[model samples]
Target: MAADRLSALPDDLLQHILSFAPEREAAASAVLSRRWRTLWRRESALDLDIRPYMAADEGQDLRNSPSPLDALLSDAVAALAAFPRRGGGTVLKRLTLFLDLNDVDSSYDSVDDPEPVDDGRVAGLLADPAAAGLEEVLIGCEHGRMRTTTYGLPLASMACAATLRVLELESCNFEPPLSPRRAFPCLTELRLRHCFFKEGCLQAMVDAAPALTSLSLDRVSQQPPDSAFQAMPAYCWVPFRLRCLTATTLELKTYSVGAEEEDLARIGIELDMPSLRYFRYTGDAIKLSLASPAPGLSSVDLNASLRGEQSQWEPTSRMLVSFSSTRALKLHVNCMNDIIYGEEEHGGAILPTFPNLKLLELDEFFEYTSSSAALAMARLLRSCPVMSELRLNLNMTRWYRDDEPKTNDPARSPFAQSMDRFNRLASMTASSRRVSELPAVLTDDGAFTCLQTSLRKVTLQFNANELDCFQVQLAKFLVENAMVLEEMHVDDGNTFWLDHLCNKLERWRADSFRRRNLTDTARFRVHHLE
Candidate 1:
């Protein structure tokens, strides 16, 4: 440069500029000049990923002691210690570590290897002097073998607690904190996935983060109920009960519904976040108790494993009452059907009206199967008077002929029954194709207010090679009834046969415009797989 102006900039400003570059590029800048020789060492962020250093060829072995990645990790930790402190701490403000601890050591060669992989080397990185100034931290481990041997999070010794604002930990075991006081006073967002907690440890950890605004816990479970303690009824099992006064967004997902019924029944979720706006729950539909009404709640996404049982129906109705104030909702097809059928089973409790609902998405939907399901769908549409958008994922695999026998065997496993029904449907797909008659409830011209007034956009997704007969009927009904419809999007999952599907849609769109006496005003588009 003519005046060497770049080197004249302050150290802090230069470090802040280098923070946006990749770690390797930032480190390589040291050779540019004398002023930049030690500048990269004090950059405010570090993101170290071990996957690139992993040697896939047979010549390089990862199991050897002091492997290349292991040595690099050690060197990085040592380098962090050498950074001079400014304002009582180093300038590092963000740190991320992506680790694969599955085959890190040669000792883990056999299934019954007595030696456990040492996690202290990874934990030591956080103990560095640079971590005291960290504002955001993310540590994620590989999912497969790492699930069995999880990294124990050493929160008690972490120096970033006072300054951290965001923390995300995946595939780690939580160690109970040494104190009950707040550990992350300023943390606003916390996400824990595939983590295990003992009885009281989860609540303690949540209570420590008093300022959290967004929280997510996926597949976080306590120890399974002991089989030998048959007489105890699993009372020692602590339900996930919390009363976060500050959180506005929450997502909770559980393991699959293979656990024993008693264990499932004992796993209750109780939340008292009065300020909550968005909530999503995906798992077996267990007991949900909301202690306070959330008047500000805007969106809800509930994906529950449902069955034809009275116990499941009543609880679901109570859940609907809790979400009466939401403006947007997403549900599975069974959930939509069960809303009416479930309330009928529970002594015809008056269904709550979604006065503010605008958008609704129904996944795994089968169009107009049985009269009860049709009636349920009609009632649901009638409730959302102001709904503007509707999305349906047409599940063609569940379609069957009218002459097939219905199977409701309780003793047989659900998976086996599903596979059997799928095989039957596959065999009859080509031969038993017939156009289905529209349900009388849906055909009623004035039954659905949303369709007549507010419904504007409709989206349909078909994953099967051939569209079901009822799917076509449903499309025609929407085009005829939705008076204010703006656009219809058809997303077909069959890649090779997209042209065939598009041709069908084109003919239908032309026919729809003629039926409505409108000339090319509606927008109909087909989305093909890339």
Candidate 2:
């Protein structure tokens, strides 16, 4: 009956059913019968995938085939054109094209310099009125070593559709003749990755999109570097209406530390927009200052991974990022070896205080001394008086190690000395007066009480054999202190130990009055060996 009912459905319903299949599979459905033959052609949505159709034999014989790239493009164009029209009208609503160009091998020495494929066949298909309603376009091509420069996209011939909103280009060249203005008028979201353009081409592209809300540029090259170009001015462009901006791998060979500091200061002084909210930059270390102190910004992520001997780690400028309206903050620094030498050399410490902060994640934070790091952490916690969630991924690699040799006697090993130092450091943290100043949720003792009273969930992840005395002490503290804890999610490397831990808890409940009190006041749900 279901099959009978499906057979009675209209072409639109049948086409929608077939749309779930891969593009090639969906096209194959047209061979079922005359009625289905024309149904795929009239379909409004088109997903043109050319990867599966590529043949290893054909690729191997590329040298003998006349214009391999052009031939492929022509076949794609013909396939789209051959689709049956609905009421003699084109039915293309959205189109996605993926191209994987193979590398030209040096062994094919017989082939002379090949002509670049100016394949206008696919471009011509996009210009048809029936396909004019395309709302999204994605073009991606694989990179090869061939230095075979293909012509830019024929975006100028594309008819602007009112419904179009997104345009993405990946590893493709956009030559002259087709400017951004003539390409996309109603576009709102644009992403460019590993694209090459002229000096002002990017700025012009952004200027043309009046309604653009999001922009991302990664590894975009303007011009090749020159030996004489050692220092360049720091670049800054403000999109008054942009709400999100992300830039990665942006390289400037001639920028000075002083110039970067000044540019950040200028940005802080010049731009003031209520709509701007999210900003992310990952490149060489650069100073960042907020214009009007981003009172409305919600989040900020900055990561710099610079290499080479000349790479400097100190934050040269004071970046007072004021996030009066921010609720979430994430700070990540990879290497801090260069910044630990002198207080005067280090840029002003980040003193961000979020009164209403709810979530904070700090990763790879390091300092030479535990006291300084602890004090800084205390200040940060104090700033977030109402903070509910905090995560610290600290690497204390250098703090506890003493430079002096521990023993002149051959009997004592370095391993034993290292263990002694580790115990001493653990004791210091346990007895430190500074621990009293942290938030009630983070204090060693307070952390246990909070787990018992306010904590609704607990997650413990550790390797059983790898668990040291520090981990044991922390685990015991948590179990003894959590008064209102409801559930615990644990991942112990050994299943036997996991089961033993659960059984011990159950037995303690069966024997101890304290356990009885816990059972009455809280629910202990254990998920072990996960």
Question: Top model by lDDT, which number?
Answer: 1
Q: What is the lDDT of residue 321 in candidate 2?
A: 42
lDDT tens per residue, model 2, 1-530? 24656568997798777665556777798777778887766666666555555553354666676444555566656656564435546556566676655442233211122222444554566676555677777766665654333334444566643456776766444444364445455767776655555345555565555566666665444431232332332122211112223221111111223433333322321223345566555554444444444555666555543334332432411222444456666655553332222334345434545655566555543433334444444445455545545544454334332443343234888667556445544554324412123223334423222343354444555332222322232344344445554555555433233233444443433334365563536655665644
Looking at model 1, residue 119 earns an lDDT score of 63
Provide the overall lDDT of each model, using Cα atoms, as 2-decimal numbers.
0.67, 0.47
| Span of ten consecutive residues with least summed lDDT in model 2 | 247-256
Measured on C-alpha atoms, candidate 1 has an lDDT of: 0.67
Top-scoring candidate (TM-score): 1
Off by over 4 Å in 2: 1-23, 33-35, 56-60, 66-68, 80-88, 102-131, 144-151, 154-157, 161-163, 175-185, 223-285, 288-296, 299-324, 330-348, 362-380, 391-529
